[model samples]
Target: MTAALLAGVLAGYGIAIPVGAVGTYLVSLTARTTLRTGVCAALGVATADGLYALAATLGGPALAAALRPVLGPLRWVCVLVLLALAAWGAAGAVRRYRHHRLATHAGAAPVSPARAYLALLGITLLNPTTVIYFAALVLGSQTGDAAGSGERVVFVAAAFAASASWQVLLAGGGALLGRMLTGHRGRLVTALVASGVMTALALRMAVAPV
Candidate 1:
């Protein structure tokens, strides 16, 4: 249970830390609207992550077994994916900064809290990479019986909590986050730091007991 919780938290933060389009939108929307709406949107994102984590936990063992023979190479593939994710995250941040492509949703009217929640949920659900990332991490897992009913609950709950906490933090930041992301140096520094942390995490995975 402890291992599952730890892994779940790490996995949640692992994916959420990358301030991609959705994250930027969440922060930007909050700065433009109310905290209530932002929090709703944050939860929506967390819900999608929770759902994907649940799917990964439920299907991982069987998938892992089927791929056991090729798990070796797949682990390497996962490593590459992680690296690519890190690089892309950094590069995307830079691009957005350079291109002035912040998700302003310019000229769009403000959405209500409920609408914000549903919109964010649908947007997040459309991201196939989120599920693939979770699935790949689950395949490489050796911590606990992720297939167990109780553990799955714990794992999913932890993942949701982790993601929710971060998303909420971003929403809570409001103008501060918006300013940080919009500022030239601040955005670059933040992106570089996030990428570095993720790279470290990927390297740790590369050396996990195999």
Candidate 2:
């Protein structure tokens, strides 16, 4: 049990610590919105991680094998999704800057906490590689060769908690950034930069070997 707990925590941080395109989006989104919304979104990400971890624990090696067949397609889909998000963010930033007023993409309503949560959850779920990552870890480490049900449960819970804690910390940092960059120009610059990074990341993902 202790081994499972330790391994699960380590696995969670191992995956969550890598701040990629989604992480950039999370921070930028938080900077544009409220801490409450950001935290909810962060939880959404953690929830995805937890679900992946659970699948890995339950399915073991077979999960990775099953995912391998669709890996390339999934990556393409993820790239498209990320690119769309980048375009929307960039457009929204420019529009808001020109009008000197805060607004969301396409005149959409401001992101509520619920909306943010669902958006983040959907975005995170697009990356099917997360499950493979968890599967590899579970097969090679976490719950060992064959984890019992109780051990699997503990591992999943620990992984979720670890991921949640780290994501919340990131959201807090983004909130701080929002406070610091209160001016329109500052927000505009930050948003554009984030959009640029997100675009580059999406393109990079598209070109990466599957």
Candidate 3:
């Protein structure tokens, strides 16, 4: 049980710590929207991670083998989605900068909490790395006496809880940062810089060797 708990915690952080496209978007989303929305989005991402972890544990090696063949293509698709998001964020930042008054208007129409959650959930799911990480945990698992159904349940719940806590902390941090940097120039700089970073990361993913 202890090993399974430790494995689940490590697995959660291993997948969450990257702060890749999804993480970038989460920060930006919080900056533009409210903490409530950001929290929902964070939970959405955690939910997806938890689901993938459970799938990996149950499906075992067969599922991993099946996913191996399509990992390359899936990575490309994830890259495309990220690039599109980066483009939209860039455009929004530029527009806000050009029309200072529009910041109020743009921020006024923030996404609802539910919609934000669904959006993040979908985005996280698109990243095949989540499953890959979970699959690795499954492959090397030494749960031993802890491999019972109850232990598996505990593992999944623990992973989800751990992931949700960390993600929520991120969202809170982003919200606090957004408040501190609410100045006109500060907002513009942060938004544009984040967009650029995301675009570069997406391009790197696109060209990366499988």
Question: Whose lDDT is greatest here?
Answer: 2
TM-score for each predicted model, relative to the true structure: 0.61, 0.94, 0.92
Candidate 3 lDDT over residue span 49-151, tens digit each: 9988787667777767787888888888888888888888777777777778435235456688999999999888878677567657666774323378877
Candidate order (lDDT): 2, 3, 1
User: Candidate 2 lDDT, tens digit per residue, 1-210?
Assistant: 998888779878888888888788999999998899999999999999888888878876776678788878888888888888888888888888888876544466779999999998888887755755775675675354488988898888988899889888889999999899988898888888988898898888888887
- Please count the clashing residue pairs in each candidate, in the order shown: 0, 0, 0
Best by TM-score: 2
- Count of backbone collisions within predicted model 1: 0
Candidate 3 has what TM-score?
0.92
Measured with C-alpha atoms, the lDDT of residue 137 in candidate 1 is 74
* lDDT for residue 5 in candidate 2, whole number 0-100: 88
- State the local distance difference test value for candidate 2: 0.83
Better of 1 and 2 by lDDT: 2
After TM-score superposition, what is the CA distance of residue 108 in candidate 2 from its true location, in Å?
A: 3.3
RMSD of 1: 8.0
Per-residue lDDT value at 18 in model 3:
80
